[model samples]
Target: MTATAPVTPDMLTIPRKDTGGGLPNLVGMTRDAMRDALIAAGTPEKQAKMRVGQIWQWIYHWGVRDFEQMTNLAKDYRAMLAETFVVAVPEVVTRQVSEDGTRKYLVRIAGGHEVEIVYIPETDRGTLCVSSQVGCTLTCSFCHTGTQKLVRNLTAAEIIGQVMVARDDLGEWPEPGTRTEADRTRLLSNIVLMGMGEPLYNFESVRDAMKIAMDPHGIQLSRRRITLSTSGVVPEIARTAEEIGCQLAISFHATTDEVRDKLVPINKRWPLADLLDALRSYPKVSNSERITFEYVMLDGVNDSDEDAHRLVKLIDGIPAKINLIPFNEWPGAPYKRSSNNRIRKFADIVHNAGYSSPVRRPRGEDIMAACGQLKSETERGRKSKAQIAAETGT
Candidate 1:
């Protein structure tokens, strides 16, 4: 769907039932939605709003799951809430930690479908890469996750659950009445919607989950620290700026439409020129200083100096930072990583053009948790030896 195209009421409705066995997950719902849900669950109308605030803090701010831990609420009221609702996140099927300290989680959501969430811990900060869909719709040639077919859009619970899951693994949640806020540093500080699926394709769930992440009383991540990356879904660009108001990143892998159409197939729909126009206007709409243009460097495809110059021209007016990602190769992938010299030359061209061009260091390569390799390898390992051989024609 184009970024600007009106999402029909039907399109906004995710097909899965939010309430399970008569108990709804309160993790994803907005404040207003939660308040209404409480009233619907036989809560007194006068107390619903107050109850939502309490429950919201207990679940999000304090990371409390059991209603018994909601000590501020009365015993009977806590029992009533426990009987009527659930606070759930995706279950971690397996977690792999790379040699460089990047942690990749294979998380199972509703319906047994799984997605990947990666946490990269740095000295000063940490970034979590979260998925919006179970698999993916677009087949970006360089992305490993694109090989899998789209399963379904993740619910807001599943989406925000990624953050919670990573926090659980990292032990980053604040403990009550302990050290001051100044004594702590968040291990999962930044979030990027750059995993498994193209986020804009699953817009509403992503937006709502991000809102939960940004809420001051919950995850409390600043809007600046969250980035929503798209493969040039033009119509939704403006809406993303107006509604989501987070940082934006484009999967601008190629300089020209001909090359881009092959690298990012979504370019065939929105194309480079049209995408640039939307990007140029993004800063004013989102009130963000700069947009990130992610250029994956592949050998002999679109990494030429000419392509670099063309890229500079393409994004001339917009405030942008160019991320030069050396292609992270996966099994059966068609491309090779650009040579170090070639990447430096390309970076030099963009740097000379006055854009901050940083070559993204490959992280979590040992565990297949770098830029694109996030399909559950454990699932692939489940195939019989004969089945694997047959698929490979070996």
Candidate 2:
């Protein structure tokens, strides 16, 4: 799709890629899908379900990438699996470590299209920001990823494979048979779908991948530990809660529809009122399961005291936390980060309104891995200015 073409709301209505190519990579399939895959590969129907469990545990729980390492299966069966299927994730093209312990990976997938995955280490937990698409579909004015045109949505394998790739990097996997209940809280403890595309735009893949992420026999992350951030794709918001059941975060930068329309262009499709209405009835939102409102503090634009008060009033009844992100500026970004004092004032307004407002510290800025800075650094000149403007309307 060219950049300037107007995107239909349901344009990403097809499957991500040709999954039927070669041996299907078993990384992102649901248990039912995998069971069917095994049965189709000539496994006896009675043995398929049992075999699926075994292989699932091997790949996800133990991080085994090779069928040869699956010693429980017979040698013949192992050979069969190897010939008929491949366990694949995105390959890390380059890894950059920040001074503050964040690791950014440039991973190349099926078409040699690369996306960035970031792992940020904190005192209590380490969170990995995984991408859903090669480039974003939405043109959020302040985001660097919005500068690129949408290539294609990532397959389920490429989606969840991000976690596996990071696990490989952190050496977070356990010995095959030695995994325990405690392994769920490892260094790569939490996952945020805050990296690249509008995840809800690629709903099915994100849902299936997150289902695998929360599978007990695999990565085993708790539902609460996973947060899927969306750029306010209203219709899919409820579906996200039902299918994914992860924590929800909104890219809620501006308070009014007028400002939000310019900041997050998706707001034009699903305006702030509609987005807020969805949030108010979000399936599981509560005091504990509060939704996160990710507000990027752009200098002199959305950082005024009036904007802060308006934000609190806008999200009044929703059980929520305001994540005040100091805008992470890119080379051609139109906005600058708000002053520290302005950010503090904005935080104060929300905090006084009985919401938990935490100013998110800019992490991995040196590596361009901070919030809103995650576009594929690959494929720069491939997209012309007209194409980008067509896609993003910058």
Candidate 3:
């Protein structure tokens, strides 16, 4: 009898690279799909159910990049899993630590593209700002990442991996084999999908990653603690509340459509009226969990006292708070940060109007990890190469 070739598993999966088109298939299978995969792989129904639990625990709780690390499983079973599935994380190309104790990482996704993840350490809380896409689709004139054209939506693995990587850096893993509420809470206190891309534009992947993030058997982050920021992707706002059920933040940088159109180009598409209409009807949003409107103050742009009044009127009757972010300038950004006096005046107007408006101090600016300052060095290199080609007429 001829000897059968050894049934070795192929386990060389890595982050998907951008291809200027649709995103790569980087294991976006849902939890149900994973269960089906386990059952189909000859694991008995009961064992398959048990195995899915085991795998999910290892993947999320431990951040294991390989199936072999699941030492509790039979060796052959681990090989079977390796042959079929992959648990991958984006490659860390560059990492920076700011003097203020902030951390920023440039993660390489597939297709030679990259995105940024930032960790801001505060006195009482640590927040990890995670990305949803490779670059961004919205060309918000003020945002550094927005200047780069959208490549593709990041896979669920890529999105969740960011939190895992941050936890690894923070050394906050649960004691090896088990997890408790106290242990998990001590790991990463909060997550905000406020990084390189527009979360609403990449809704499906963002939703999947969030489901995994909130899964009781996995990351177990509370819905109240998670916030999804969008630049008024109006059509999807209600669905985000109904499906994802996380806190909502609108990137409402300007009070009027005329100014908003120039700053956030997507405003021409959604406009303020439609965005507010959706917000008014958003399900489960209440005064206790008010929507957050993020206003980036640009000097002599949207920081006038009159502008703040228009903002208060615009968001009238909506239970919301405002976060006035002083623009954090990147090298080639066209706008300047608002003056301290202007920012304070803007906040005062909104605050006196009986709504909570906080002026956000720019964080991680030294590391290029602050608000609107998250383009990767790899993307900057690519732009330089293109400029050289144009200059040399090659």
Candidate 4:
């Protein structure tokens, strides 16, 4: 279950990021973990629970990082917390705001490594695309992040910290004692794990971080509001429902195993048959809570009349929605996007069957914040277009 196991040579240079240089980080810990840390730090057993509640509200609900800002706690107790722990999130290195109101954040983590998180604003919801790893291992030929090699998995704190950072940028935190009700409208309403890395690859951190996100007194997002998109990690599918119970999305671009293996290389290991079987039995799938099949439209690649027909047939008996994403081009990317008419034709075919197939409008492309365009700022232009074409067979 260790992330380092599969990443042998890739993990040679990577060390587990320090937890605040040896002091425990309070940002990503579970409530029980925090309680244990508090008691270990000399808090009386009875007072530890109340102390954890106070610190949790200060750190999460109020967006306060400094222990001194937690005015409710005794000054001496605050001093003990300050000396024993640090509340930290990824540092924002550069932020880009798209013309369409999408914000892309390039944040610096420990070891000077970097990752990107995007906040996309929509009419009814604002979706933040969160990354799980520093780079990626899937190497999906159409994806920009896949071009870069994997670095390491992010810690639980770093995972949830992405949300905290976005909230800080959007000023979403309420004043102390203001409210904890779910009635108020939020600027960042929904979260999608469709950012830089395959979320299922770093399963435990993602689960723990999502648990923090859905906690009632803290960030307080509902289970239905958060969606975890994976590239069809079959074994972890059930755990996502039984444990986190958030929405599930699959990066299902192709209709056949041949096409899928070339585009999403991981499909070779767990092909469409196995992936579909897992989706059919997924505990979260129902009429109201359908699993999302994210299909990127690559011109003459995955977008065609036959592909659309086969796609609907493949997902029968499963409560599913198809998200037809236009291939978001990046520099040196080997594939071209499907034409609008072609994409719409494919959507029409799927919609004709019982499922909802909507062609996703390309967002934040001008700023390179669109889907499949998320690579670390440090890991760009290492390969020529011809080299990429050779690798992708374009």
Clashing pairs in 2: 3-390, 3-391, 4-390
How do the predictions measure up, each by TM-score? 0.90, 0.92, 0.89, 0.92
Candidate 2 whole-model C-alpha lDDT, 0 to 1: 0.87
331-351: candidate 3 lDDT, tens digit per residue? 667788888988888889899
Pairs that collide in candidate 4 are none
Query: Model 2: runs farther than 4 Å from truth?
Result: 1-21, 179-185, 384-394
Per-residue accuracy of model 2 over 1-394 as CA lDDT, tens digit each: 0111122211112223333357788988999999999999999999998999999999999999889999999999999998899888787777777766677888888877889999888767889999999888797889989877799999899999999989887887888777376634478889999989989989999999999999987888899999999989999999998988999999999999899999999989899899999999999999989999999999988999999899989998999999999999877678889999989988998899999999999988887889999888676657777876664446
Instruction: Candidate 1: give its CA RMSD in angstroms.
Output: 8.3
lDDT of each structure? 0.83, 0.87, 0.80, 0.87
lDDT of 1 by residue, 3-73 (tens): 12222211111233233444788988988899999899888999998888888888887788888989989
RMSD to true structure for each model, in Å: 8.3, 7.9, 8.9, 7.5
